[model samples]
Target: MDHKQSQIQEAEHAKRSYGSLLNVISKQYGSRDTQYADFSGECYKAVLEECYKKAKIDPSEVCYVEADGCASMITDAMELNSISEVMCKNRKTPLPIGCIKSNIGHTEAASSLVSIAKAVIALRSGIIPPNMHYDSPNPNVPALLNGVLQVVTEPTPLTGNIVGVSSIGMSGTYCHAIIKQNPKVKPTKEPASPIDFPWLVPLSGRVELALNTVFEKIEAMPFDEEFIALAHSIFKTEIKQHLFRGYTLLNAGQQRVHEVKPYDGAEKRPIWFLFSGMGSQWTRMGVDLLRLPTFAKAIRLCHDVLLPKGVNLLEILYSDDPNVYASSILHSFVGIAAIQIGLVDVLKELGVEPDGLVGHSVGELGCAYADGCFTAEQMILSAYARGRASVEATLIKGMMAAYVLKDVINFLGLGYNQIKDQLPPEIEVACHNSEFSCTLSGPVEDMKKYIDTLKQKGIFAKLVNVANIAYHSKFIKPAAPALLKYLKQVIPEPKPRSKRWVSSSIPEALWDSELAKYSSAEYHTNNLLSSVLFEEASAHIPAKAIVIEIAPHGLLQSIVKKSLSKCTNIPLINRFEKDTLKHLFQAIGKMYLGGIDVNIGNLYPKVDYPVSRNVPALHNLLTWDNVKGELISSFMKNKKEGSVIHSWDFIKIYDKRIQNFLGYKINNMEVIPPTVHLVS
Candidate 1:
């Protein structure tokens, strides 16, 4: 995360990097500092020797030198280049030395700092800066005469990892530090996060008001090129999360950030996992999630497996090319299954296992994995087979016109048993989501006719735009044989289910039976041909459970909340959100508040920002600056201008006793001070 570039954006960098430590170093010293100079030659040698020993490198590897260039650093006197040659005997060419003081002037106290800073820049850029105003080297210098030292009068390439820095103090305190090149890679033009997505900065405060106020402040500031770097700073969560927390959503497209209401939702409750099925799959569902490495890896794993089977899950889940998810039944099934696996992997990475679990319809594929019944590959391949088998019914042309999952407003559901006799026999309940909520699937024309009939009677119903295949119905019976055959071949045999795994498709009465066992092909075939008993499944959720919907988008949130009214329901993804990645983080924050031990570090990218040690303040130096005088001047100016005279009045009061005494003592005497005016 270091932004110290040697050049390129010179104008911008100049403002921030132009300043250096002036007070920490000693000021310029003249002939009186002969004592400090006496040890200069010895000091340089010791620093060089100590650096080589510490780094375990030879003198030949020290190719660049940042010299202090003070009065006596290279004096010709008794100090010998022949002595230096003996120390650096392995050198092929003279040591290239550059003077920073030639350009920035001798910062006596800060000379060593200036030298090191220049050396660091040189090491990073791999090129030494040219010494300014160097007409010729002094002929008296022993190193210059013996060719032991080469003054870098022109720009030169720095070829080694280590560079030596020398600084001489006026107080006889010689200090030296080494500058080693950092081999770390830096961010290029393309950042890890895509430009189209918004940057959500999760914020926390000790008090609720602070979160909102800080969000408002963030929104008021101007945005520019460095905003992504700002995202890195905001992503740092080491600061203790306080009682109140929230996030500010920033999109590069917008000039200002969108503020969200702050909350103290970390109320601590048991976390339950609920996986949503088919209708939740949307085109490009994985576009934002792919940015999450843990999630993307799972998706890629599934993609690599499913791609060879003529089903491209990556395109299905992340492409909005002419609604591939809706038109192709295979894409729909594979996309939902692939996204579910990714979501499960991300949840595990977050370190929150389901205290309780339920999966609706196709979501059962993900549920089986979460319950340890199916591995990542088995889940993905099972979904591929389910969709591949669904091709058997493609020509039949049927669709599911459900009462829910298309949107939140049509939250009402049908109790399948209650309405069993009312509908045409061709139309059957596909899913019983809640006490009054369910999905109805039938032939495409019949489904539309039924919905239109309801519409004429002023009842609202809409087509599930994401799904055109009539799943979980008699219409899907044609694909059952193929589905079962493929599933049996793919899964081979069912694994033992976890006790915490609740059944959404299988009723609670059959939970103890082989039906809840998800016994390979038969269970999946039966699941497709029968309605989802989600209401029966949610019965097993704990009274205080905090439910999280695991899918590319949310569909069963309303049903979960209604069934487990006492529990908290947090849908991890929203199809309508600007950035699903941000939505996932907010969901994790909710789970964290609900007592789930989520790994907070997993939510953000790894970052390492360089830090500097604290030093004495620059106020130690004497200056012509007068702050108090300016403050008083400002105060007087404001006081003079920022005032108004509202009203003025004069009051004359006579003291009866004094007036009487004066009038009696001296006749014709008027005891009055001349025009006395009092200003208060």
Candidate 2:
């Protein structure tokens, strides 16, 4: 009755606030105080008869009726009207009238909401609960005395969409709310279109064991339309006590869990993209990614730009044939460029962006394209011309090997001039990879001899497992001019003069004159001849930056990890892993942990599955606060031990206090006393 009165008071306030915009009308009455005269039971019956006549709906349309059963008189009056509405329809089933108060006692101010909630549940579930009391009808009521209505004695199965609930205050403030299940709302049981790729499901638990339980429950269930919809509905929420964070990827073949270490005390830092060069390519580097339209489109774009030169890049990428890698270096280099570009597109979609970028050898071409220095067509042409030069130099029978120096010896313990004099003319220091490591290039026999000499001194050395011609050495210097000449014809446009570039060829700090020289053909020719200053360029990277290797494998990441002082290495792709989809998602999950915001909607470009629009079940967990005493308080003040609580309820409670303090109270009592002092 108090709830009904509060609704009346709110409606009255709305009338004063909005003037003519408010439309208030009196409805049927039902209440716990069953005295017919006090709660106006006759008005309730009149409204029900009038509604049935006006809407032309018989009582048979309503499967069940929930009445405010604070007393027998209130329920008996609603039952009488049900019979009057169905008199002309010849309906056989008596409308099952139930009262929530019979089962769960009167809930005071929550009585009306509870009764309405029960009615909605009954309509959805098709079962009407029995009125616990009143095995015999009230003989005083006209409906029972005349045999016009019957009381439901037990649980009954109902078969209709409409249900009705009523509540009335003691002073005759009557309310009636009719609930009708809309025919347009579809069932969630229907099968949806299959997802061709893996879907990520974010899970959160208060403890480590809770996470294991969550995973076990998911593993036991079949992957279905509802599961897919639930997976895509993940959202961010505040963590409470000891959160176990990570996500699982669901696919047709198998499921994989990518566990993120529970967040430690750390701050968000910047990130860098480290793109890969040649020798990272395998036969089918991007075969698994072909299902994605964005990736496939990027591959098609490369094919279109290079097919005129008689190369089909997709045939090699999608084919399992071992000869694909053996045929030509042009195909492999072009595939690397195409895959990296496609990866950049997908990363942007996932909301993981790089603050800066660095690339190795031909990998810099993709970086150049990303920063607007090279267009897609120009990048393809440049890769092809460089690969052609490399294939020509293979005839010289020279290769590159990486070596780590022992004891930080200066030029092998001899003076620079003496060491240069003793060394063979064919051997050259190809790469200053780091402070401790360098790559050497020469004829195969000279490389073997140098390795033997270094091993005799207890220095670590190994031959790089690549079949390419020796880069950054004099042996390939003859191939540079022709490659540079072709690049100039194919790319005649002027440079954009982007300052984001970091050169691997020059070891000095880049000046404006040097930046402009990147546009000239001689600059590129010199790049092919001179050693790569990778260690020098790495020094330019800012402090606390994270390096993400964008490649088919983690080959460059290991080198970068050893070179940098205090930086983290994240690999976007892994050639060693067989499940490419799971590996890619793990990289994304790690980025999220590193404080990057991911827009999950972009991950689903094709929304044929009709994902559920509902918000996730787990929400912001409660926190401790000191209110009146030293006792701990959660964000949910009225929450009990095992009941679900809502944030909107908390908001409503505070809103009422604010309203009382602002002088909107029914009584003159002040919420904030004048004698009490308040702190802001």
Which prediction has the highest TM-score against the true structure? 2
**What is the per-residue lDDT of model 2 for residues 1-680, given as tens digits with 9 covering 90 to 100?**
01112232332232111001112124634454655445444576666666555655664666666776667564545545543453314656555677888888866557887886676456544567777767766655555555545556677776777776767655455555566642332355544445587766665544456565665566555555444343444433324432345566666355456564453213456777777775678778888777766667777888898888888888878888876765666777787888887777787676666677677766677667766677777777788887777776535766677765546545342222223355678888777666666677787888788778877878656665345567778888778878888778866864753556667765564545564346445555566677766767677777767777777666676567766658767787888888675677777767655545566556664443222222111221223344657532233322233222233322343575455556523357534433222221
Model 1: number of backbone collisions: 8
For residue 490, model 2's alpha carbon misses the true position, in angstroms, by 5.2
Q: State the displacement of the C-alpha of residue 148, model 1, in Å, after optimal TM-score superposition.
A: 35
Q: What residue runs in model 1 are displaced by over 4 Å at the alpha carbon? A: 1-203, 213-242, 249-267, 317-320, 393-397, 404-413, 444-449, 465-469, 542-544, 558-567, 585-597, 608-680
- Could you tell me the lDDT of residue 645 within candidate 1? 20
User: What range of 10 consecutive residues in model 1 has the weakest lDDT sum?
Assistant: 613-622
Model 1: colliding residue pairs:
25-109, 25-110, 26-108, 26-109, 266-593, 269-594, 413-436, 413-437
Candidate 1 lDDT = 0.64
* CA lDDT for candidate 2: 0.61
lDDT of 1 at 126: 68
